[model samples]
Target: MRDPAPRAVTSICRALAEQIERGLLTAGSQLPAERKLSEVFDTTRITLREALGQLESQGLIYREERRGWFVSPARVAYNPLVRTHFHAMVAEQGRVPATEVLSARLMPASADICELLQLPGLSSVYQIRRARRIDGRLVLYVEHYLNPAYFPGILAFDLTRSLTELYASEYDIRYGRVRFDMVPTALHNEAATALKVAVGGPALRIVRVNRDQHGRLIDCDMEFWRHDALHVSVEVPD
Candidate 1:
């Protein structure tokens, strides 16, 4: 005793999945209009949506805010314990990576930032905002807060490049200790808009503080990522 409509739903899902698996529908490709798809399958909109939902849960599909569904691209594998920087890490995974500097300015450190970096009240710092994309999809937005006392005139340099390389070449500072805090949360405001996700959509927030060999905190980075676009993996040392 099975519902006849459910059988049709499964069949429709199978057909669409075949198209995706066979490359008829490429990754990041938007689906046809819902009404058009419904007519093609001769099914109700609710039925079609249920099938699409299943695909989404299976990681075969995803949706953007105010945008329709699309086939999901490969997820980036990230190892938090490693010292690799963002641009190099993404490239090592065989994906094209790009970064854009959104904003950069010298600002007075907040109380929380001062405590994190062990600075006095109202200490001046450099705040840099950037976005990272892989395969033309924005995956993460980051805010970098650095202690400007360590690098005088850092603002004169290009902020779009890797800070790790810059630090090694100019300041001879390499990471000695790195601390990471990760949490699952909802994206909001500028971060949401940058990643093209809804304000309340699921995301992974990562806060990282880096220290130099002298045990001095150099900078801290806050990263907001699309949950579906990244898979983090790390092996802790003894």
Candidate 2:
């Protein structure tokens, strides 16, 4: 027999969650009033309110004082200290991961790229642009710049594969340390298009500079993600 007390609330929450996940209830869509939801689920008003509260805590819905509830946009979390690749992170969350390679080429380093990589003027750099997805939803736009000498034939490698793993297995290039800076930003046209958000949508811009075991700059990467899609966490040891 099903447990009766929480069943009704859970059912309502699950139905709403499924609709949100399947895009039937889109972001910013206003949910029905509590009475309507209770009637729809054949439950009491208190139970319906509990279900809405649960969804709100999961970042799936928001309640306004007088406006009822609206769908909360999706979000993702990023950890700078983790050494794993993007694919691994998404996989660990049981979300599908995919990448669209926008551009990859060998080019002379721009001044900023040269400075970040500590390369001399005119040194070759492998520049790659990719759009990342989670469960078929566009989420991140990334641009990576690498020292060509440190990662030859990188452009030819399967980019969807883990770059860190490829470097470790093939060239013994491993990240010994990483530095990250984050800032709030508004999505630009290209980033908005890649991330499937409107222009001026809130974003978290992360810039990472990774160094190899030898203390040489290995890669400089910039990532832009929808602000609603991610959470960041750090655990401290006692």
Candidate 3:
């Protein structure tokens, strides 16, 4: 006879999915404990976990490392062609945005960073690491590598604010051109830790290279976002 565990998993998944869709489980609200949920479903913990995993893959729920699962909020629409910054875009979508600076220092540019920023070998760059939250949920971890020659004393400024505004206000330079590269990836150590997700969980990686109005490469940002947190959208003019 074929196994019945798959059926149990499917049943539980459908039940939970209905609850979420009907708003019985609100967005960002933590699910009940695993043991409680398993008992409620009258199934083995393994089966319940499988069901939860399926929901997670479907973007209806998410898990944080050491923390229980939560109902996922609606995805934020992301338009790469827009020139707006992170805070602005997120706010425009009616979500509260907050950023925390993790680290900032002047460091020797790695070969990869140098290539992205068009810097010579052995040049130093200012590196800034940050975590961004939408409506109090951590969603993105980013690292920014800036060509030091362009911004002197940048470390003295507040790093938690939008770098785009900072560049224009302090340095009188604005972003003119940008390139984007994105791929689905497994969360690495640092990004996973920062986002409080399990190592190797699914993530979306976006690498952005920016040039100033003078056509000089100014910075590059590597952003790792929760895969469920974004909906990519773009409009092309005829």
Best by TM-score: 3
Using lDDT as the measure, which candidate wins?
A: 3
Q: Per-residue lDDT of 77-168 in model 1, one digit per residue for the tens?
A: 88987778988998998998888989999999999888888889979889999999988888899999999878888778887789998888
Backbone clashes in model 2, listed as residue pairs: 75-228, 75-229, 75-230, 76-229, 76-230, 77-231
Candidate 3 residues lying further than 4 Å off, grouped into runs, are 1-3
Q: Looking at model 3, report the run of 10 residues with the lowest lDDT sum.
A: 1-10
For model 3, how does the per-residue alpha-carbon lDDT over 111-189 read when each residue is reduced to its tens digit?
A: 9998999888999999999999999999999999999899999999999999999999999989989999999999999
Residue 220 miss distance in model 3 (angstroms): 0.3
Candidates 1 and 3 compared by lDDT, better number: 3
RMSD of candidate 3 to true structure, Å: 1.6
| Clash pairs detected, candidate 1 | none
Q: Show where candidate 1 strays beyond 4 Å.
A: 1-24, 41-58, 236-238
